[model samples]
Target: MLFRQLFDPETSTYTYLVADEGNGEAALIDPVLARVDRDRRLIEELGLTLEYAIETHLHADHVTGGGKLRELTGCQTVIPEKAPATCADRVLQDGEVLQIGEIPVRAIATWGHTDSHMAYLVNRDRVLTGDSLLIRGCGRTDFQSGDAGTLYDSISQRLFALPDETLVYPGHDYRGYTVSTIGEEKRFNPRLARRDRSDFIELMANLNLPHPQRIAEALPANAQCGCLSETP
Candidate 1:
């Protein structure tokens, strides 16, 4: 298996390229539109054919590169089945395994940040944890279809149950922490470490983060991978 973790400093987002080095067939996860060209260049440089561009959920920060990848390479778009987006070529169900150059990637439902949010488990050791889990904290449950209590359950019940050695790759993290082990996060993440559901909710409520500037504009476009009919 081959992997590359790309970060967009502006939005603190992470894009990933996972491929089978044996055959050069690859897939991208949660890519950023602003850096699509760079990612495409790397794909070409590696002599890999892009097979799929996956989005864990509709983003509220920046536009997604899934559609642009499709436009450029004719790659298929994979997303969760519950997503409201119509552009996904494949709707993934929990426990479904997708083959990428012979490697099996399993989909895990993690609905907290959004009702349709998902986490991709690769070979049972690495997880693409969209917005559900981060290095020192987790995603805010104040957004669309988000419930604080539900988020708590998703973490303790679903993610925390995984093996301690499993590696985690989150969607966005601004603190420069790229990746972490499930055990490390479980024992150290300020929010999850406490194992207190009510405390987590209270912390989120007090964050007072301003609504994302492009949220309204980004959602509809992101849902469809920025293929919205409106002008940009």
Candidate 2:
């Protein structure tokens, strides 16, 4: 297996590249539009054929590179079945497995930050949590049809059930931490650690965080797979 974790300083987004070294086929998860060229260059340098550009949800912070990557590499664009984004080539349901060469990436419906958010479980060892679960704090549940209680349940029952050693890679990390394990988050996460559903809900409800800076431009653009000119 070949893997690389790329970061975007502008949005604090993390883009992942994973491939099967044997077959030289790969997938890009949650790619940022601004970094598409860099990502493409890396993929080319690594001698991998880009097969899929997958989104965890319709992000409100940054436009996606799925459309551009598809145009550049002919990779299919994939998103959660329930997401408002209708431009995806494939809409994946929970538990559906997407094969990138020999790797099996399972889509896990872990809605919390948004109504249809998903996390990808790669080879059953690492989980790519898209805003649903973060390092110490989770995503703010204040907009885009967010529900605090639902998010609490998703993390506690779904994500926390993974093996204690399962690696956690989050969508964005503002605090500079790169990765954590399920066990570490379960024991130390300030928001969910030892907190009951009610407690978790209460914590999210009062965050009072401001809306994403790019929401106005990002939402519409993301809905169309990063076509900024398309109307929402």
Candidate 3:
């Protein structure tokens, strides 16, 4: 399997391109519109055919390039089953697996950041954890379907339970820390280190950080797989 992880510093978001080298087929996870050209160029350079573009959730930050990629490469666009999108070619369920060439992509339902959030587990070793888990902290459960208890379960039971060596790549991060092992986060993340759930919730709720300014525009756009203004 061949994988390319691309990061956007402005949004602190990471986009991934995973492929089966032998078959030259690939999938893009959580892509950003601003970097679409670069992503496509990479695919072309690698001689990989874009097979699918998967969204972890309806983004509240930057618009996704899933639609543009599909228009350019004719790849399938996939999102969670309950998503209110018209462009979701494949409404994936929990544990649904698809073949990107030969590598199996497993979709894990992780609804906290949003009601329909999902984390993609690639080949059982790497997880595209959207907004569920970050390198040194967990995503704030203050907007949308953000729930403290549910976020706890998503992290403790669903994600943290993975192997210690499983690589965790989150949707967004403010700090420079790019990635971490599941075990590393379990032992070190300041937010997850707290044993008291109430404290964690309180801390998250009290933070006054402003909501993503582009949310109003991004959600609908993301729902349409990046073409909110266009008719499919």
Candidate 4:
């Protein structure tokens, strides 16, 4: 397997590229629109064919590059089945696995940050947690139909049940941390680690976070799979 993690500074978003080296087929997770070209170039340089562009959820911070990548590479665009965005090529249900070359990417429903949030478990070893679980903190539960209690359960019951050695790759990180293990987060995450459901809920409820600056523009654009206009 081949892997690369790419970051977008403006949104603090992380895009991941995973490929099956034997078949030269690849998939991209949570791609940002502004970095589509760079991502495309890297995919090409790696001599791999793009098979899927997967979104963990509809984002409020930055526009997605899924549609653009699909247009450019004929890659299929995938999103959670419950997400409002209906433009994706595939809408996956919880536990559904999509094959990217030899790799199996399983969609795990982890809704909380948004009504349809999902986390992908890749090849049984690594999980790409889209905003559901961050480095030391979890995603804000103040907007886009977020629920703090549900998020707490999603992490504690579902995600934390994975193997302790499983690697966690989050959708966004503002603190410059790259990766962490399930055991590390389960023991050390300030928000959820070792805390009861009520405690986690209380923490999220009192966060008083500001609304995402790009929500107004990003939501609409993302709903259409990042095609803001037909002029392009």
Model 2 ranges with Cα > 4 A deviation = 230-232
Number of clashing residue pairs in every model?
0, 0, 0, 0
Structure candidate 3, residue pairs in collision: none
lDDT of 3 by residue, 49-89 (tens): 99999998888899999999999999998888787788778
Candidate 4 structure, TM-score to reference: 0.97
Give the winner by TM-score: 2 or 4. 2
Clashing pairs in model 2, backbone N/Cα/C closer than 3 A = none
lDDT of 2 by residue, 109-136 (tens): 9987999899999978999998999999
The candidate with the higher TM-score, 2 or 3, is 2
TM-score for candidate 1, please give it.
0.96
Residues 74-127 of candidate 4 have per-residue lDDT tens digits of 999999978998899999999999887888989999989999989999989999
3 versus 4: better TM-score goes to = 4
Candidate 1 Cα lDDT to native: 0.88
lDDT of 2 at 62: 99
Candidates in order have lDDT scores of 0.88, 0.93, 0.86, 0.93
Q: How close is candidate 3 to the true structure, as a TM-score?
A: 0.95
Model 4 off-target regions past 4 Å?
Answer: 230-232
Best first by TM-score, ranked: 2, 4, 1, 3
Higher-scoring candidate on lDDT, 1 or 2 = 2
